[model samples]
Target: MSIPAIDLMTTLRSGHSTSPRLTWYGPDSERVELSGRVLDNWVAKTSNLLQDELDAEPGMRLGLALPAHWKSVIWALAAWQLGMETVLDGGDADYLVTDRPDSSGRHDAVIAVALPALAMRWPGELPAGSIDYASEVRSHGDVFMAHTDPSASVCAIRAHDGQQHLHEGLLTGFAAPHEDGVRLLVAAADGLEAALSNSLGAWSSGGSVLLAHPDVELTDKLLAAERIHGK
Candidate 1:
C-alpha cells in the first residue's frame, strides 16, 4: 500500500483535523518549524497583542517589523485574522500586485502597495490606508465574510511547496479541478497579495513568512500558495 499525496487545503475543508499546522522561523544560520497548540496559544495571545498594539499605531496598515521568525509568521497571520491587511512584499515592503486588464481594453484594477524596497523618498510618504494601521489591519473576520459579495470558491492550505512542489505562491488563483487536482498559474500581483492576505489572516494557524535575503527567489513559494489553495 502507498500513502497518497494529500492536498492540505482540501483536507482542511473536509472536516478533517489531520491537515498539519506548521510554522517556519530562523536567522541567517538556523531555521526551524514549530507546531501544535503552543503555536496556537501563542497566536491567540498575540492576536489580542496586535489589537492592543494597533490601538496606538496610526493608519490601519501595520508592518511586521522583525526578522523572519516564528513570531513574525504568527503576527502576520494574526493581523489578518483580526481583519487587517497584511502585505508581503517580496523584497522591499511592497506586496506583489496582479496587473491584469479588465473586460475593456483599458486597465482598471489598482491596489495600494507598501514595498519597503520602493525606497520612499518623501516625509511620512510611506504608503498607507485612509485610516490608521489598526483600522486598516483590524476588522471583525465574521462580518468581513458576511459583507463580502459572493465570489468564486477559494481553497486554502499550508506547507504547500513541500508536497505540491509548488514554488512561491506565484501559481494560479487555485480552484478545485476535481476532488484530487487543482488549477493554477502565476496569479496577478494584487490577486496574489489579496488571496494570501485572506489565507494568512484566516487560517486556523496564521500563515508563515520565511524571511531571507530581500532578493531571495520567492517565486516558488508564491506559486506554492496556489497549490496549497487547493484545499
Candidate 2:
C-alpha cells in the first residue's frame, strides 16, 4: 500500500515526539535544545497565528529577513505548513518578518521579531502597523490544519546562484541519506540554502540539526562535544 503524502508540519509532529530535533549554539556559547514535540508546538502556534490572525493563505508571499536563528527556522516551517511562499530577499511580500530594530519594507503586514529565546515582546513601539511576533504568537493554539494540499508550493528559493528556480517539488525530492539520527552542524556562513536544505533533509530523515551563529566559531572539539555527525 502507498503511504499518504505529508507536509513538513505533519512530518515533524509524527514519530518520536520527545527526541531532540534542534540544537542551536549562539555567541557566548549559548546553547539551546528543542525536542521534536517542542518544535512542533512552536510551529503549530506560529502557523495558527499566520492562518488565523494574519489571514495568510497558501499563495501568500512572506518575506523572511532574519538570520539563521532557531526562531527563523520555526517561521520557515510555519510558512511551509500554511503553504505560503518564503522570499529570503524580502521582495514584494504580503507580510514581512524581521529581527531588525529599524523596520523598512513595503510589505502590507510587518512583524518585528526579538531573537532572544526568553524575550516575551519586541520592546518599544514599532512601525505603525507592525506588531511583536513573540507576544502575538503565544495566544495561538498548538495545532494547525492546512488549508491547501501538501503537493502545493510551500516555498521558493533562488537556484543556480540566483540564475534559476528551485521549486517546492524539487525541494521535496531532495531526500537525505538513510542513515538514522544524523545530526547536522550548520554555520551562518552557509546562508539560507544550507539552512533550509539541512533542516528539510534532517527532518525528512528522522534526524536533527545543530546551528551556530556567525559570531561563534565551530571547531572539531565543539563538534565532538556536540556529537554533530554531519555538516
Candidate 3:
C-alpha cells in the first residue's frame, strides 16, 4: 500500500511528525548544543526535499547507507516524513555499486553516502540495483529546521536471499490503530540491538516500525548480525 503525502512541519505541528527521531548520547559538553543546532538545520533541509518526493509517492522506497553517527539518525527521519521507505546499509555498503543486489520485488535509486569517520568497516558498494547516496544528496542544498515532527517509522533487516529488506508503516491505523494489521516494508541491514530496541519501542507506542518479525526466520537475521558485528 502507498503512504499519504504529508506536510512534515505541519505533521509535527499536528502531532504526527515524520522526521527521524534520534537520541544521541554524548558527554555533557558545549558541542552537544552546537551539534544539535547543526543537525536540526540539516534535517530541516533534507525534510523538505524528501517531503516533496513523499508528496508525489507516499509508497516510495529509499536506499540509505546508515552511517554509525548521529547525523544518520536525522537523515533516516527525514525520509520517514516523506512517507518513503529507507533501506539501510553499512557506511561502506556504497562500494556494492556494481554489485547492487536485486532483492525487493521493486527497484530503488542508490545514493553515495558520505559517512562519518569511524573504526567500523564500511560497505564497499550499494545493493545490485541502487544509486549512490553521496552523489545524490551531496549537492542538494537545504538548511534544516529545528521545530519538526519526528514520528514516522523506518528500519532495515537481512533477507533470506542474502539481500536487505526495508520496511515502513502507518503511524496510526485507520480502523484499528497499532493492531499489527498494517506494516510498511523498509530498508535492510544486520540487526543491531540498539536499532531494534528503538524500532520495537515505536511499534508498541503506536508509532510505525521498519519491519515485522512474525516468523522465526526473521529472528535468525538478528543472530547473524550479532555473530558478525558483535564484538
Candidate 4:
C-alpha cells in the first residue's frame, strides 16, 4: 500500500517542483526558502540517513525532542517517508532526534540537529554517541528507497496527548482545514503538532506554508512580502 505522506511528497515534487513549498523566518534575521524539489531533497537525505545509518524501518519509533523549526519539520517528514512512527512526546523510542543531547541518553540512537540554515555541523561536541545531523545528512543520497512498505493501518504518529494516528488518516483526520492554494502562515509558537497539521493541509491542497519563529514579529509588511493568505 502507498503511504499517504510519501504520496503527498510525490505530488508536491511533480506538480510544482520550482515553487516555494516551505518558507522559514527565524531569529537573528534568518530567512530560508525551500522549493518543492529542494524540500524533497532534504527529506530524502534525512530518510536515507535514518534508514541506512540507523537501521530505521517500519514500526520503529522515532522521537522528536525538538521545537517547531524547519529542521524538525524535515525530520518528521523523513520519519514518515521511511515508515517510522514519529513520537511527538518524550516517550520511549528506538531513536531520538533532538537539539539537546544531554537528555537523549535513553534512546538507542541520538541525532543532534542544528537549527541554523548555514550550519555545517553541530556548534559544539555532541554526546559521545550521538550523530551530527547537519554534518552527516548532507553526505546521504538525495533519493530514498524504502526497504519495506508500511500498511495503511500502521501507526504514523504518537501525539503529545498520547493519541495514536494511523498512516491512512494522518492528513484527513488531523490536518487543519484551509482553502485550496491558500498561502498559510504557521506560527512556531503554536507548537510542532500544529505546524505539522497545518503544513499537511496546505501542501495537500496545492498550497504552501510560511513558518515564522516565535521571535519574528508578524508585521503587515512581512505578511505582504510573503503573500500570506491565512494564519
Which regions of candidate 1 are displaced past 4 Å?
A: 1-20, 23-31, 56-59, 66-68, 88-231
RMSD of 3: 12.0
Q: Indicate the residue-level lDDT of 39 in model 2.
A: 90
Ten contiguous residues minimizing lDDT sum, candidate 3:
25-34
Ranking by TM-score: 4, 2, 3, 1
Runs with alpha carbons beyond 4 Å of true place in candidate 4: none
Clash count of each predicted structure: 40, 0, 47, 0
lDDT, candidate 1, 1-231, per-residue tens: 101111222223343233334423222333333333444444444445444433312113334334333444455444433433333432222211211111221211112222232223222432332222222322422111111221112112222332221112212322222222222222223233333433332332323223333333445664375344422
The candidate scoring highest on lDDT is 4
- lDDT per residue for candidate 2 within 179-216, as digits (tens), equals 56677877867776568767777777778888889888
Q: Write the per-residue lDDT of candidate 4 for residues 1-231, one digit (tens) a residue.
A: 688889988987889699999999999999999999999999999999998999888889999989999999999999988778898878789999998887436888999998899999999878789999989999999888898887778899966676788988888976778789989999999999999999999998899999999999888888999997445
Report the lDDT of model 4 for residue 111: 92
In order, the Cα lDDT scores of the candidates are: 0.31, 0.73, 0.37, 0.89
Model 2: residues with Cα > 4 Å off, grouped in runs: 1-6, 101-105, 147-155, 163-179, 219-221, 229-231
**lDDT of predicted model 1:** 0.31
Instruction: Identify the superior model by TM-score, candidate 3 or candidate 4.
Output: 4
- Considering TM-score, which of the candidate structures 1 and 3 is the better prediction for this target? 3
